[model samples]
Target: MKKEKIQLKGITWGHTRGFVPMVATAQRYEELHPEIEIVWKKRTLQEFADKSVTDLAMEYDLMVIDHPWTGHAAAQKMVIPFDDFLPETFLEDQRENSVGESYASYNFEGKQWALPIDAATPVAASRPDILQELDVLLPRTFDDLLALAQKGRVGFSLLPIDVLMSFYMFCCSSGEVPCQNDEQVVREETGVRVLKLFKSLADHIDERFYAKNPFKVFEDMTQHDEIAYCPFAYGYSNYSRQGYARKLLHFHDLVALKAGDEPMTSTLGGAGLAVSSQSKHIDVAVDYARFVASPEIQETLYVENGGQPGHLRAWKNTQVNALTANYFVNTLPALERAYLRPRYDGHLHFQDHAGDVVVHYLKNGGDERAVLAELNTMYRESLAWEGVHG
Candidate 1:
């Protein structure tokens, strides 16, 4: 007697980079296993970041999730750890070849919660043709960025979440990391300086960007000609690929704070594949995740289909580089040094709300110290939920 076919469903964020590869891989997987079928659905990018994993797990067999939710996933057991199901040798290979901290970010409480299928960080992007036509060099320092913004040629995403990420970047660049202790996000001195620096550029850029995210900013840049340069946005390889957009964007490292300082450290932004604990077919889900995250698949089908692969093999693959105009190679350094966000159970509370506080200050020119105090309050509240909930 023949076995009955099994079906699985997965959820990923909406976007070619986030959605297409999963669909392609699922189709291929079904071809390889005639007894199985996989369907993929997508949510808005913001929803992908904000939705509760536990809720999603109830509906899907697989989830593409942000690393910051690992703590909650681990505490609630909403997703099973790959460590118990995947082979040690395979896990070891993932660790050895991880792009920066990509592999490590999903391991919480000593168990691998997810397999990083993509890796990204904010990197500089520009339309080389536009920059050349304008006879302006790409900005290399803070002052240079300000000068370029003054000319009304720079594009940046200032959405509340983006504002929070930028605040983290400025905090780190100013020689302090945010959310180090339970008491505060950062020292008042560093927080104040970072906000002031942020305000300087926020004051200059076009006001329309305050409502945009990286996707919209990239769309405006590629579809229209107004944005010649974006100093920092999550690097989207699709924008750089031939025929993927109306115009090609060349990506590069971020500008330094000073002429001699190191490139700015941006917040990490990527998605990982996790098996839902609620899945009826746990073994099948894990198998599919492993196949998707494998180097051979990631370097070839994944990248070719618009996915920004998390595997280092893909990052260094010549064919992958050729496909996306070396987008991986150009932005790898930023991913390597990217600051990992806090994942302690309730950190999402802060991630969700703190951005509003930062954005408000940037737009209203309020007291920086007061902003820091409010952020500290939020930080404490997030920490308070640490061990209390799933």
Candidate 2:
């Protein structure tokens, strides 16, 4: 007898880490339950970061989303809150085993908007062959990194959004964490130093860096020998594996900053799997999400296929360690202590525009005081935007 199969569509970022796990999980789930089939599509990483979940929800039954969208998803009611469909025990397990704030980042206004399936943040990457050739050692301090960048052996993503993230890192590195108060994003003195630090790096590196994203930087590293190291970029474990790229990258935690012995906290980034509010096949979508996020499946199948697992168990698994040359073990400290972004309802608008303000100050030498004032104004405005939009 021929089984009647129902097809479902999903959207994820167009990267090896973003696309493979979903397809692998869907294929396994279909083998177990022949009546369902899931087809996943992908958009560029930039599009995935820039596109609104509400707009994507209307077209697809499922979506892999950024954690920052939790507030927007809740305000717009674009995705199903997972509490009802997923068992309470399952949700609790996820929270207990989450890598840092990966689980909490998706829980907004006490509603679970999505299941985190991938966990990542900015970390250092280098070509060991290039490093050895240059007779340079891996950096362990911010001063060491700056020296390396000065030698033209360093490169990183400094695109608009990347610049904003780097500013956040600089703030934390200097002992002035941002978004700590309702009045302003950061203390004025700290904001000034952050800008100066960013500009100092920009001045030393090539202008081309300001236009590239992390993925592009990694792609360039693999194809050329111009840049030997990247001090910080979102870690893609796939690039560290054998035969994954033209050249394999070695990833580790970032250099320690002037503020402390610990490395500066990178902004948290990872995608969550969610069922759309408008989906007719809600039951199937939820089941598929659960299948993808399960610790056992995540540790074994998902990691094998190039996905970075959010589950703590997978991160600690010995087999997972062996495959990627201990990539997870090396970067876990960075992920567990990563900094989280603001998830307020109107935070998106502020983030969308704040990048340009920082980039302008970085490119054109200007009054950093004005930049801080502009950011503070944007922060206050975003809060008000939330009130009216709420």
TM-score of each: 0.99, 0.97
Please give the range of 10 consecutive residues that has the lowest summed lDDT in model 1: 381-390
Off by over 4 Å in 1: 1-3
Pairs of residues clashing in candidate 1: none
Residue pairs in collision within model 2: none
Residue 346 lDDT in candidate 2 = 91
Choose the strongest candidate by TM-score.
1
lDDT tens per residue, model 1, 1-390 = 988889999999999999999999999999999899999999998999989999999999999999998998999899999999999999999999899889989999899999999998899999999889989998899999899889888888999888899999998888998888889999988888899999999898888999788978998999898788999998899999999999999899899999899999999889999999999999999999999999999998888899999999999999899888889898899999999989889899899999999989888899999999999998888888775664
Prediction 1 TM-score vs. true:
0.99
lDDT at position 127, candidate 1: 91
Summarize candidate 2's per-residue lDDT along 30-147 as a digit string, tens digits: 9998889899999998888789999999999999999888899999998999998999999999999999899999999898999989999898898999999989898888788888
Best by lDDT: 1
TM-score of 2: 0.97
Assess each prediction's global lDDT (C-alpha) against the native.
Answer: 0.92, 0.89
